[model samples]
Target: MHCIGNGGFFMWWWIASAAALAVLIVVVLLSSVRVRLKYYREGENDEVDASLSALFGLVRLRYKVPTVELKPWLNGIRMKVAPEETSGVLPELDFAREEIRRFVQRVRKLIAHMKNYKRFFADTLKHVHVVELRWDTRFGLTDAAETGMTGGVVWGLKSALLGVASRWMSFERLPSVTVTPVFNQPTFRTEIVIRTRMKVFRIIAIGAMLVYRVLKRRGGWIVWLRVLLGRSPKESTA
Candidate 1:
């Protein structure tokens, strides 16, 4: 009887542990994820910073482009990537072109595996909330008239972008925007920051559904296997 009692205790312990684990998973999936972006440009210096954090920073990713003002015509563009206090430089234009090509190819592959990518992207992004947005720019030209004209154009562009962005996302707060025209000396500077938040569960759910649909397609698994093996779509075995 004692042995049976101990067996029952162990079984209950296992059941309780499983229940606790399921609760924890639900909490994590429901947690909020934050995305941030900062772009700065002053004179010839420009840089972009981006980060993502979730569960009070337990899960985080930091990405930055140290110098975005590379002169492609003078000495070829240089891209500085720094992560974990380490930096690597690559030719900016060439690297960007290759990445864009791969991205396009990936989109095409996804379309072949799971048709209707437009719907997924639109649906997923629509749920993303713009929690904060701030943009400030200062510009100047030797001529006052030119400076005024440019400032108006900049303001117009900012308004147009905000209008479009608002249609796609729910803005938690009105964007703080400013544009100053300095006519004394010829100079220009701008800074833009945006913060977004979304529920981790929704994103994961959508992505999982997309993956499930893709894997259900004919030979879809083989398509990704080739990609994993570093073989382009053109490569085939008889």
Candidate 2:
């Protein structure tokens, strides 16, 4: 009788431990993933910094892009220079009309993907909460009228972005914004910071939804693979 009682007690203890572990997992999964983003462009330099955390700061991560340089190119196209020093291993790069065509095709494919996956993304992003947002911009041009027009365009862009955010996510408070135009000088600068959060469980659910959506269609995996490769299967078929 003593041995049987001991075995029963051990079995109950194991069961209780298992239950406790499951609860902890659920709690962690339900915890919010906090995100912070900062992006800035001043004169010839721009960079982006981002951070993410979850489970009440038990998990944390950060990413930063130091800076980017841009220069005027032929045909009014701007050329991007890597922030790091060049290795000098590769030859000078050139762009042909074919490259421009390819870029346009890729953009079209991206738009199509957005249209197809609109529901999937909406379902995922609806769970997000906007904690804070601020965007400050200063721009100048030789002509005062041009500077004024540019500032208005920037304001419109900000308003559109905030409208989209409000449509998809819950906002804790109104966002702050500022735009200043300097007509006497020729310069451009902008800074943006935003904070948001979403539950880990919601993210998991979104992943599940993606998988289900992909599996539901014929040749979906192939299409998905092609999409990841920056090409469409129909392009290959043609």
Candidate 3:
């Protein structure tokens, strides 16, 4: 009887030990899961709570070309104004021709100014067509490899980018721009359009780091689990 009781006690102790270990593992897993959930929750909350000023405080002038290019060409037509000795008409055609001449001369000066900015000129003169420009912006994730958030790096990037664009168009010589405000959730983008006398092309600077910082907190555990399960993230394209 004593021997049986001792065996039962030992059996119960072993079962208890197994239960304790299982509980410990469960607790550890639950704690890890809780931490991750909290991280994602905090990340999402911060993203939602982020102000437009914070997200887009950094402004870049990505490209500034003469967005509008104008060339001077005569519309082929001649006006004949006649006021002979017998005719009592100071013909309106003469006034119209004079006004057109003045307009052509003004356009020539503007085109010359545009030429001083770019080395290469378009080899064609076409009719004035309005090519409507639209502003596009988005909120999304970018891989960390492609984006950066350092002040010096951004400054250098801004300088180099604008320098190249300046070689293409004289953005500084353009008139003042008016941009309409657009309020968006967590992100905002503004579009400005103007009827310019010169061919003007503009490139808005977009910062890669603007949205990258907000999304880097996901996937360590998921990555581990995938590896444990004999799977892995697919290799990214080179």
lDDT of each: 0.80, 0.75, 0.31
Clashing pairs in 2: none
Model 1 is weakest, by summed lDDT over 10 consecutive residues, at 90-99
Better of 2 and 3 by TM-score: 2
Instruction: Please give, for residues 119-189, the per-residue lDDT of candidate 2 as tens digits.
Output: 87777777888899989998999999988998899899989988987898788889999999999799989
**TM agreement with the true structure for every prediction:** 0.81, 0.72, 0.17
Of candidates 2 and 1, the better by TM-score: 1
Best by lDDT: 1
Off by over 4 Å in 3: 1-159, 172-185, 192-195, 199-238
Using lDDT as the measure, name the better of candidate 1 and candidate 3: 1
Off by over 4 Å in 1: 1-4, 69-77, 84-113, 212-225, 236-238
- Most TM-score-accurate candidate: 1
Clash list (residue pairs), candidate 3: 62-205, 63-203, 65-201, 66-200, 66-201, 67-200, 67-201, 68-199, 68-200, 69-199
Ranking by lDDT: 1, 2, 3
Q: How would the candidate models be sorted by TM-score, starting from the highest?
A: 1, 2, 3
For candidate 1, write residues 93-184 as lDDT tens digits.
33455555766786577567654666767777788999999999998999999899989999999999999988888899999999999986
